[model samples]
Target: MNSKIQNDIKELVEEQVISKEIAASIENYYKSKKGDTPNRLFTVFAVLGSTLVGLGIILILAHNWDSFSRSIKTVFAFTPLIIGQLIVGYTIIKKKNITWREASGVFLFFAVGSSIALVSQIYNIPGNFSSYMLTWVLLCAPLIYLLKSNALAILHIVFVTSYACSFGYFNGNNTPWMYLVLLAVMMPYYYQLLKNKKIHNITSIFNWLIPLSAVIVLGTFVKKSEELGFLMYVILFGLLYNIGKIPFFDNQKLRRNGYLILGSLGTIYMLLLTSFEWLWKDILRHEIIINSQEFYVSVVLLLVTLGVLIFSYSKKRIQNFNLFQYVFVMFTIIFFLGVSGSIISIILINLLTLILGVMAIKIGADKFHFGILNYGLLIITALIVCRFFDTNMSFVLRGLLFVSVGVGFFLTNYMMLKKQKGKIE
Candidate 1:
């Protein structure tokens, strides 16, 4: 049984917050579960301990590395790999539990990379850093399935992102197209994890990781019309925003819903970036090449975002119809206008940002969510700060605007708390 659940209701009843009958029902519900979520520390420390041991072995070997003969070095190289394999194999057959599986998978993962690096060093193998990361990721990806380890899955995504960075950045003409395939291969496992109907810590991690990986790697696809890359990003974020509205993800806690968080934040950030007058001024200098690769990617992204919006509509996932969900659609028109050297687009964006913040405050108040309300206040503050330098507005007016917004923040929060107290009484 979960110890925290037991303690919580016992305390609640003592405080006269709930009757004994309700407490008993709550206790029975949890006690009837086949398995509760594992204690967080157990899995974390298990994986951490195995990783430290693996590093220690490597460090010790490096100390005596040059003193040994080629045969001795070769033996040392394979020792950890062999031991890790045996442990993982045993885990699969008998000691199949979260601690054993994650520890073994992580240990074997590091072993595979170390062994490969050692072999390359001893044999003087010729390879770049990107190629090595690719090989390492490819070899360890199966560990995600073989051991059914979420820790391994998260590590796999990290390594995959690192590989993209190595292969795509400043390297001559090397596109990391294989990254999409690698990420796709891991989706089946993610789908299965979600279908389990429990929000494990690991579930929340993948929630953030998958989108983060894509957002990081998406920049690698920029070959032409470099400025349009920003547009592609906005559209991708919009797609992510729509994806968040899906029932499976929306019903989860805010921390677990990475698509919504990242999507909303990313959109706001891009909006802030675009609101600058100089950006559009620069875009006017360069030719808006519709024939460029970035343009094509942006088109695909817009279509996909639109498709998701329509699908979400059919399913009726968003209950309140968030205005920011259509931010992509709105920005598409704004972007074209900006590129055409229209000043109206920038003004519209400022208005949009202000409206978004206001809507956020309203939503937060309705939900009694202090965090959401504050986030909305921050959004407006960000916009005002962005506009501070660009316009010819005087210092007095700007200072007045700042003072007004600051006062609004305090009053809104105070009212919200007072209302919540009234409801409680």
Candidate 2:
């Protein structure tokens, strides 16, 4: 039962808007529906408690390592894993509710990692951290489904992101292709979370984590023609934005719609940063290998983004996409326009920035939302700040430009608030 609804019911009855009997009946109905749902706070603490226990156990065993015999060390190494398994087994067999399942699953997840490390250390296993991370991730992947644990799912995303960094960035490896496969395997669970529509907080966390993990690991896919990865990132953000606009997520609040937030911000960041002449100059000067892995990856991402947009159009998820959604498509055209066209592309980028900023302001004003309105101002401010370094305009001129924008911010927000306040009155 939602506490907000319950409070409203209680107040209604007290105010004679609803009879006491009707309030009791409403409360009973809701309690019957949601009584089994675990308290979200308890769920968080349970997972945290299990994590601390797992860490404390590891610390205790490490403290006595020198004194233990080989057999004792082996036993100690497996102890936590065994205990975690028992707890999980009990939960499954007894059909324990979400709290126990989450706690046990989290404990087992850490236990698996700890056990792997301890055995490797004791037996002198020769493997890099990347390999260990991969092994741990593969081993713990099953626990996510077995325990039906969102906490474990979140942990899986974190580890896979770490694995991508370890392998792709530090290991002299090119692309961690397995990262995609690992990421793909988790999608079904995410889909189920959305389909169920219960435990919204967990669903929201996954929403945020999934895109954020992709954003973090995206750089790992970049190789030669590495500048092309910027194009790939914008398309990826476009895809995320499109997905966020799908019916299920489109109805949610901006705070809950992680894909849209990340996509919008990411598109802005990439577009602004690439608005510089230096990047365009570098692109023109460099020899981009058409056959490079990065090039192919960019192509794949573009195709997929286009495909998603088409699907969205067919489904009527959006009658029209925001200007931010088109950035990726426009960026590609500019990306290919090399040579002396760099100047033209730079001009186009600046225009796109200005147009997007203006559009945001208009949308914010129309929606009468202070957040959206301020976000538009923020974009314009960022653009001006970027121009601060890139232009030869005199200090006095730039100062005036900044001052004008500052005044626009104040006036726009002031007018919006006045409108809102008058409407309220």
Q: What shift in Å separates residue 49 of candidate 2 from its native position after superposition?
A: 1.1
TM-score of each: 0.91, 0.94
Q: Which stretches of candidate 1 lie over 4 Å from their true place?
A: 1-40
Candidate 1: 10-residue stretch with minimal lDDT: 31-40
Clashes by residue pair, model 2? none
Model 1 lDDT tens row, 1-425? 67887898899999999999999988777776636656568889999999999999999999989999999998999999999999999999995788899999999999999999999999999998889988999998888998889889888899999999889885666779889888987999999999894487678888999998889988988876888887889899999988987888888888899999999999999999888989888763366798987888899999999999888877876577798899999988888887777789889889998999999999899999999999999999999999998889999999999999999999999999999999999
Best TM-score among the predictions, by candidate number: 2
Top lDDT prediction, candidate number? 1
Model 1 alpha-carbon miss at residue 267, Å: 0.7
Please give, for residues 342-365, the per-residue lDDT of candidate 2 as tens digits: 567778878888888888888888
lDDT of every predicted structure (CA atoms) = 0.89, 0.87
